[model samples]
Target chain A: MTDELDRDLLLEFAKAEQPLKSKEFTTNVMRETQILGNRKKRSLWLYGLVLLALCILFAGPLVKLGTMFAIGFISPLVSFENPWLATLTMPVNNIASIVVAMLIGGRFIWKKASQ
Target chain B: MNNYQETSEAGIINLARTGDPRAFEELVHRRQSIIRNLMRRLCNDVTLAEDLAQQVFLKVWQSIAQLSRVNAFDGWLKRIAINTWLQYLRKNDAMRNSLEFNDTVYVPPPGSNGSVAMDLDKALLVLPEQVRTCVVLAYHEGMSHPEISEAIELPLGTVKSHINRGAKKVTEMLAAYKQPTAGEKV
Candidate 1:
């Protein structure tokens, strides 16, 4: 009863026709998608290049700096007669470097957050 | 994709995803009338419905690849069309709010048959947005309860409740209109 009435009304509503879009709409959508796709590709390439440059600039230098600092500072303590002390202090030096790096990273993030 | 090649509708979607403008055009041609009708019923405005229908197709073109199941294209497209209109309505909330606030009276235009159709439309307009959407999708679009729930992202129980409430309201309005007023002579 109610279902039949609802169904009839729905059919009547569905039978109503809407105006068609202009022919240009299809071409316009394709063009817009193409433009967006191109922009995405270019931006991805740019990000890849920037990442490569950052790795080149930072990776080798950071590793070298870490190695040099570890050897320069820890080698002296390790060269001493007390090898156990040197071993213990070697871990301390590594921990200290890691702590310093984390502090600097944290401060940078904090600054950005505050802004 | 070729699995659905025998089905022209699925084939059209596959081609459209692969950037075949003609295939996409065919898909649009086939479904435009239905989409337009759905839009008109959902929005209650013919011109806006047409514009939204075009926007729906444009979105379909742009996001075709993201659609994996070709068979469910109609449901997917309908969801897009519904969301597009919902977004438009949300953007124009101020206008709707003002209209509602100023127009408290629900005066029926002359020559209304006091029939089920006019009563239902009037009753639907007064429903909450979510409920109205469910009713429209269920009744107007011929979607099953599950389909309506999925399209509108509502729970099945909620969808059923909406339909029930919407139907009750329409029935009540119709019944009220049928009864004679105190001042009116038989």
Candidate 2:
């Protein structure tokens, strides 16, 4: 239902009129870009350093946890056990070992499958 | 840059892709007007338009490396501009669910062609932001519905309806001006 008059009016308004142009516009954009660039550089360095520090700080706990899990996993495979415990407390020891092995194995499979 | 002064837009884009600030600044200078004008009309606010323009350029600079085709620069830049404005509109919750055909009558100057355009500009400000965008892009920028849908990230049907409703509203509003005032000398 649009008429010629409406079309003409819109075209007239559409004609480019740069009333807002100023040298400051370009300068402001460039300045903002410069500030952002500097901020990005600083943030990248900070993030990298923070990540490295976190890994270093957690290395001991992470290694200890991994070793504990690895021992549980290996005990099932190796079947190495103290002779005295095997004789006197064989059932309880076996149950504890089985529980540990299942927990560790399930966790390892979940992590690997997710990755 | 003096070296980049006569370079084509594609050449400048390539340089900007590689982190040349001068080239990016040059790109901004070249495309600033169209982007600013589109934003100004879309927002109907000069200050917001300028702010949006800056954001569009900043986004373009940030994502310049992703633009594999140099010829798609205009389309890409416009999409960013439209998206930025749409985002602003969304954040403000300003999209009107229904078009309000305001009763303010435009009294066009007698025998003057420019008055129609001037009054139309004023009339445009009263439109809902989404319709105003579609109207401006369709009539002013001469964009097709598919192009507009792609740029605005709206469905094609939605773009068509907005353009139709917007144009109808504007035409209806302007229809009032064509009638002679009661006391005017014939």
Candidate 3:
């Protein structure tokens, strides 16, 4: 029967010797793992240091400077009552309209060129 | 000269999870032979198989912490090995894409003098990669079709067909070596 044939053949295959083990296999694997582990540890330390630096920066004069810039940037958009706010909003709006116009023109030209 | 031999696999896995190189090394030493054998059969290139086996162990070392079941270590290791082999095949798409049939000849042992198992091993190398992998897993590894499907990430139908086809080929190749019965002469 076909089953018998398959069984016999498979049995023969199963008798094969296991692939010969390399003498240095374990040593090489260990060495690589150690190197990988060290790299991971160093990366973690670097991340920690960057986080600490960011915390220190945010706690210092950087926070005040950032807050001042944010308020100045947002004040014109939220309300343009002061002359300085009008000045800031005018240039920003003009630049924004110019960029939007350029984008639309570029898209039309690109579509024509592509076609 | 290492004390690693005294430790259990679970103990070693714990150490490896904690990034202990010696413990991982011990784990490698214990399991490398089976993994290498499986790789050798799957790839049919001893050097490539060895390299892939090393990669499998490296993966195990790197991702041991992600394994949810400690007792499923063998299955986990096999899954990693199979995935690594599949990835290699995927990257070298040309190997699978080629229409060329493997033409390696299977020379049967002369007059039953040599080991049939040795001949079978050589014959196995001649099979197409997918078929050989299915046959080896089903027979040598004692895996069922469904298990092989999941492990190899092949469809169940394809796995079944590959096993059937592979078994038939092996049987045909080894038919000459089949022993004669009482009425038949060798």
Candidate 4:
């Protein structure tokens, strides 16, 4: 009986242990965790945006070169059908247009990179 | 208690990992009371206990994702709490100085009823930090000897020895208070 009583008393004392009451404890912890979570999300989005920008920056030259090759290959067919037209306008106009588009794209990329 | 079970500590941990701040807060609310009590017993200073409690929760928040195997949540939190307390003891020069000075001659004032509860708190304070941690984790936190050993990173034999020695010392202290000294007249 004595042993049982001692055991009971010990258990009761253990059960009574409690944490302190901080008025803003929960609020403070939640706010901090939320901020951390948001920061993680923002960093992931930033990474995605950087990858997209790189794709646009490098794909521009490749696409322009491909377009120039396609025009050159089709030039013979067009000249065979209309000799006067081919003689009047050299393919330099196509190359110039490509160069101008590239210049504009490059200016935009440089502006973004500076920012 | 399906809702309670569904919101069980494991559930709360999962939710907290998925960015549910409310779930993390719920976990804190559920465990804070016991944690505060443990801190109070360990530090024997309410203000310090409160501070340590906050630090414990902050750590729990920061490391929630690293907690795998949800069943061990309580044990994991207890380990964090113990480590946080130990770190605080190590870093705070003033507390370290006080602890060293007080260790030899610390005694509770007379006249209060020698309640088992009060005696237990005082007894816990008199123990060395590692022994006190083992005792508190074993008795107060309902952890087994193995659990206490794991939480405090001590050997199993050391944990057992601390519990035995701590309980014996507390028992002796309480017995001394119960028996009157010869010089005093009732």
Misplaced by over 4 Å in model 2 are A1-10, A13-22, A66-115, B103-120, B147-158, B168-186
Q: Return the clash pairs for model 3, or none.
A: none
**Tens digits of lDDT, candidate 3, B88-186:** 877877336532235455655445655654556566766777778778888776788888888777898988887887777777766654544456565
Candidate 2, B69-162: lDDT as tens digits: 8889888888788789888887887664455644453444444445544556656766777788878888766777887788777788988888
Tens-place lDDT per residue, model 1, B3-60, is 3334577677888889776677667766776777677566656567667877888788
What order do you get sorting by DockQ, best first?
3, 2, 4, 1
In the predicted model 1, the residue pairs found to clash are none
Candidate 4, which segments miss by more than 4 Å at Cα?
A1-9, A12-16, A19-24, A31-115, B1-11, B89-105, B113-117, B153-156, B177-186
CA displacement after TM-score superposition, residue B122 of candidate 2 (Å): 1.8
Q: After superposition, how far is residue B101 of candidate 2 from its true place, in Å?
A: 2.5
> Can you write out model 1's per-residue Cα lDDT over A1-115, one digit (the tens) per residue?
2233364445544443334564554455456556766888999999999999999989998999989876665443224457687666665455456666799999999999999
lDDT of 2 by residue, A1-115 (tens): 2222255556555554445564577788898898888999999999999999999999899999998876664443334368765566544455456786799999999999999
lDDT of each: 0.66, 0.74, 0.74, 0.68
DockQ metric for all predictions:
0.17, 0.22, 0.29, 0.18
Steric clash pairs (candidate 4):
A18-B33, A18-B37, A19-B33, A19-B36
lDDT value for model 1: 0.66
Query: Per-candidate RMSD vs. true structure?
Result: 9.1, 7.1, 8.6, 12.9
